[model samples]
Target: MHEARSASVPVETRAADYLQAASMTAPLLGSGSQETPAVNTYNSACGELTVLLRSSEGGRLWNHPVTLTGNNSTYHLRLEPASHAVWTPNYFTSFELEQQIKEKLIRKENIHKGVGGALVGVRKVNPPEKFAPPRGITAAVTATLDFHGKDATLALRRPAKQPTATVEGKTRPLAANFSAPMSYYQPPGNLMFVGLLGGFNATKYPAPTGLYFMQPYDPDRIPLVFVHGLFSTPFTWVQTINGLQADPEIRKHYQFWIFAYPTGNPILYSALRLREELAKADQLYPNHKPYIVVGHSMGGMLTN
Candidate 1:
């Protein structure tokens, strides 16, 4: 006999409550034909709730952190084959939860036998805390996809396009993937932090000079370069870039970039460095799109 595998996900509060309520209606499945009692575990010691189902022989089945969907009272859960479990809410009475599991098992067997094309790149799992959404999108929508076949092709199904806007006497598709404001600025290193606070000389402590992209660089689009003032890192442009990204027109046409340098550097020297970086980028991409440079505090002089 094959041992059952398990998959665990963090159960969100709303889904957890719905699961607990549904479990009271029916017990979970176990090995053989016996039905196993449903036990809800709440870890008050750590102020956490643990919801899981076990088989009749005391083997574990479905773990919490599963996805639940439906209206207030009706809920349906979908778990991976490892857990080998299925659940139905109190409303799905004609087919009891146990019967539903049996049907699901049959379906799984059919799937494993190559019944239908596999649904690849369909992500229901959430990412780690460091990687959250609405901040920045690094990859194209298709980047989330994975495939076992080289011949596999992805079809992007999108809703109807939104209205368009007129630019330069021509109507164009509006750029509409706008996200809520995120703080992309804010000096990341201790050196930059101390430079802002006090005790800083460019000669003594040279700030690494480089062109940093605040967003993914699109060569086809115009560039909007932001230069921060004395004692401030690229983080000084955080709010400014946020404002620009929030605007639909600006987001559609320009990519945001920031220049970071030790604040103690002389204005002329810093500006020379900025000019060199800009020239380098132009040579690399060779796109003649418009360039918009904005400067803050002493940065205003660099812009000149």
Candidate 2:
């Protein structure tokens, strides 16, 4: 509420619109919040959510890429069904890390990239009036596979700007996850252990000493860099990042990034590293929006 009234937040309007559209669209999709539970599976049968996720270390979401997810989608259809994904949040220290390595360790995909999910509708193609529905695969089919990934992201951000989909001859708001990539991003680690590890041995579990994006780097949205304190790693801010992004206002306008450095290093050296990284980013993304750097504890000194 406070942000909506504040003019300084550049994304207030778009964020407000997304929230409004979501409220109106959720009930229609039959995937309402905990408070407004789905009436029954029958209602949700009209639509089903397929989360598209990238493979984690030593694991893959599937054996191979299947139809309806990647480049195979057809845009001419208007209602393109897309795949959905999730990155489960895992910030708490995994006690196992301390046992095997006997050292606080940060284990992540290391490489952050890949597709999100999609919400598609599946309904009976043949009318129910047909008392004698045909067996086999003739009774029901995938009614529509609307939008997915980035395509869905833009539509929900500014609902009015894009064309609405017609489902069952009725216009409907394109269903999508308001917060992509971030909402599903789950980085597994013990923050305290990893932080101390980095602070103790710069080389063993060193953090990338540059601007690392939590999501795809959006040129339009301003960059918000989070720096962790002494004996801390970017994992320290995972929950904080998740919470901030839950709000449409912040998610729409500001892309989150992190400045990770081995806390064991001298503060002056780390600050210089940050300055150099910012300069490089500016060069790469010319005419980009101003940046907002946030620091905690020792991180505060680096920002200053």
Candidate 3:
């Protein structure tokens, strides 16, 4: 009779050991404060294993085309900071980075096994300073697998200098000034009204007052007026005003004015009213030159 041979350790147990060893050496490989090392299984045409990673520093969040090796699929991962800056408050606070990595792993696992899924187990390694005991600093690795799919995701949020506030049942970051902008207008009141009128006998006027002036004080340049069409307002030219103010070529030649009007009024009445307004401008600012009128849509028809 032959002596019974001692049984070897199971493949799964050996694999777990290899993973633990690799995780232990992860810190030695990178100098950054955040590190993520995760393993996932996929049965696509490519292969059965997939690994994803993101450094504490903002660089490549996902490392694709990763290959696995070893008897039980033990793999080593090493990452370098994308820039010289420390991977701290700049990109992601320590707490945010830790949370991100944990979530990433949990998502990966769910994509591997084809069964009912949820986060099963999670383990944290070395966390950042913000994450202490009560506010523990550590990495969380989670496993999730479901009948539909399996995957993991990681997230990190670090402790702040000033503890945040819980307001209206929601935690909000502390602000230097917690005041809302003051408003001059009150709602639910008709403090403003809209109207339109037309008269064929209205004087054919020129440009209006304050229509022209120099870059520093020129009198020859023509003033341009922009009239917006339906459902529009003076705010439309805000960007144009800013651009013209900055450009030496355009700024030296013209001054821009935008007209806002109610859209519900009849198009013909608005146009006739606009023509009368232009005549008045021409009469008031004779030195400014007859204004160059620009109108959009209905406004264009009126100006013509």
Candidate 4:
């Protein structure tokens, strides 16, 4: 019978090789700089993997989402020098774009596995000129994403010439009049749940106990205040806030507020405290419209 002929099998492809061979095109924004009299432009139009932008003085400028377009493939984009009430530019403006493909391209290769489905192909741009409206020629930039035989133009703009009207009135100052105490933002985890039966010891937890807000107050959106039950902190409503914020219509029509107090307090005392807080808030904000109050567990009796 002798030695049988050895079976020939092809080696399975690796993720790196599959990613490297991904069928996509990279346009003008790439890896090298071309200096000129007026502006310096960098081109990495081919084989571009990643790009990053950092302020010369290390300032973090906010970025805003404009839109996500295309089918079968999608592009995520952010505008440079995101206009903010606080953060200001110290140097040149920058923007970023990423490409994502939904359908699996290679066999046994999972894209964005364990990474929350984030897309790769990140492109960062730092225009040589400042973002302010024109003193010289406009800095033109183009972005394109192609996948599954579909091509999408991500962003194309002359930074100095695009109208600035879009950013106006989009948001308000979050830390000024509508700020909440630091503890409200940090949920106490299991301690919050255990505190219910712990009585007066519940007050010992580090988180503050009082009224709090999830976002800056807006006159246009009616406030929906939530009150938590015995042994519970305002943190209990975090998931509810998340769910509400996910619905664009709900988020647009309402602002979320939370009321936290020591569960050990008498229900009548808690109710009285809530009434006082409401009066104070109404006085400060001075709106003619009635407010919405929701409560859970013992807090529900107080609400009633």
Candidate 5:
């Protein structure tokens, strides 16, 4: 006998306290059916709280293809954006620094155009790897004006926690896909070569440049900057960051940053440039918390 292949998504099993949409009243398929459980949408406190994600150029994403990934849970994912991750300085554009190092900046995300697409999450059960549920309605709405405020719209652009919505007063854990925003800034495969080339050709690739941010800046959280050694980029810190971020205390109190420099360059020049970048960042974003710099290899000398 062949082992049955399971493709069940982990959904809330508790009593359904929330009102279900009339359309959802249709009887669920029988146990042996091949169909997957459909995405459940219920009435929210806002009557119908919905997520409306779109491209910056005003294109529709409803019909676009998506993939699924996660362990013990199903996450709907779209890899097109991730595959096209950038390596340029302005992976985003326009911060106050261009106009004046003197300008007081609240946060850089306010100046960012946004990274990529959203991660769709499934509750735990099936592997987060390639778990796609099928059959859903699609429609588009045109409005005279958007109802979301500046903060809401801005938050939507930033990489966020599991994509979730509160229905009534209860918070439900929906299926969640991963958020890999840093990958959007610089593709890992190219970092090593870039760091190496930058050392030899100072003109082609400069050292100790653009302060890369992984998230929106907050005055409440202290900044923790990571400096990588020769022939390396912040990509080296991935596992370390993954572990640290797993800690709630670290996540609450610290914001991560990276300083990229040409490793092959003279130590002093690289150090000088690091200092200049830090000073400029301080002038623009004067936070109450002291800066925390961590360095590895040659990056250690400069951090000091």
Candidate 6:
């Protein structure tokens, strides 16, 4: 007889109440008055009320605890000051909290493997935690990937993108996939190479293999491989590759290489083919250090 798989798994749930959208009018408080509080939105399942604050100039101010009064369809809020108030309009029901969590998990998973992809089913689950203010409001986010059916945890930290060079000294904005190559050569040891590999069909017009090199000063170490996500090409890593190349600390450790492929293909098929290509490359340069594969988005999913 075939065994049946267990149906229920515990999921860790975390709640965050943020000011989704709000507008500031003449700040006036009180009931039965023409003035009303600014409205924000949130995601909640149990009909819980969470307070959110907004600044008149713009942006969020603070989040507080409040009770959600009224029926499930429409929520009514009362502020302590009762004067000019900040309210969340139909807050709890309008957001896709679960989907957001799933996307976050998928992004986190890709970071470790140096790839990115979509999140699938949950193998295991845990209880959610209440929202806490993060350290840097404008800082880049760090993602944590906890895979189900496995005891592995992957933490991915991606730096935010800064402005890039303009075209012909003009202020023309550069595309995310601009090409920037930096390479180096090491003497006696294994050669460490790094850079961005252009995707197969990137430009509307035919483009050559775009390889952006980031080699160590010594040049004799095995290079690390960086794989990009779906619909993304080697150009996506231009900023990251450039930063790593410029960092003296990173330069001393290893070389870098970017792998670009046609994102239109199936992820597994691409990965399998990539594995074979890597094998062939390894044969050509036996002394080169083994590659450390990194993929993003769909590429991340493929790595697994």
Q: Quick one: best lDDT, which candidate?
A: 2
Return the lDDT, model 6, position 15: 15
Question: TM-score for every candidate vs. truth?
Answer: 0.43, 0.50, 0.29, 0.43, 0.50, 0.32
Give per-residue CA lDDT, model 4, range 75-140, as digits (tens): 333433423211222222332222322211112221111100011211223351221111111111
Model 6 spans with C-alpha error above 4 angstroms? 1-219
* Alpha-carbon RMSD, candidate 1: 18.8
Can you write out model 3's per-residue Cα lDDT over 60-137, one digit (the tens) per residue? 323332222334334332222222111121232222212122221111221111111111111123542211112222
Residue-level lDDT for 88 in candidate 4: 24
lDDT of 6 at 290: 60
lDDT tens digits, residue span 178-201, model 5: 223322233434655776776667
Off by over 4 Å in 1: 1-192, 197-199, 203-207
The parts of candidate 4 lying over 4 Å away from their true place are 1-184, 192-194, 197-205
Error of 4 at 72 (Å): 34
Error at 38, model 6, angstroms? 63
lDDT of 1 at 207: 43
- Model 6 over residues 5-122: C-alpha lDDT tens digits? 1113111111111111110110111121121232101111111111111211121222232222111111222222211111122211111112233221011221211111111111
lDDT of each: 0.37, 0.42, 0.30, 0.38, 0.38, 0.29
Q: Lowest summed-lDDT stretch of 10 residues in model 6?
A: 130-139
Error in Å for residue 112 of model 3: 58
> Would you give me the overall lDDT of model 4?
0.38
Clash list (residue pairs), candidate 1: 9-65, 11-65, 186-235
All candidates: CA RMSD in angstroms? 18.8, 18.5, 24.3, 17.7, 16.8, 22.3
Please report how far candidate 5 places residue 281 from its true position, in Å.
1.7
Clashes counted in candidate 4 amount to: 3
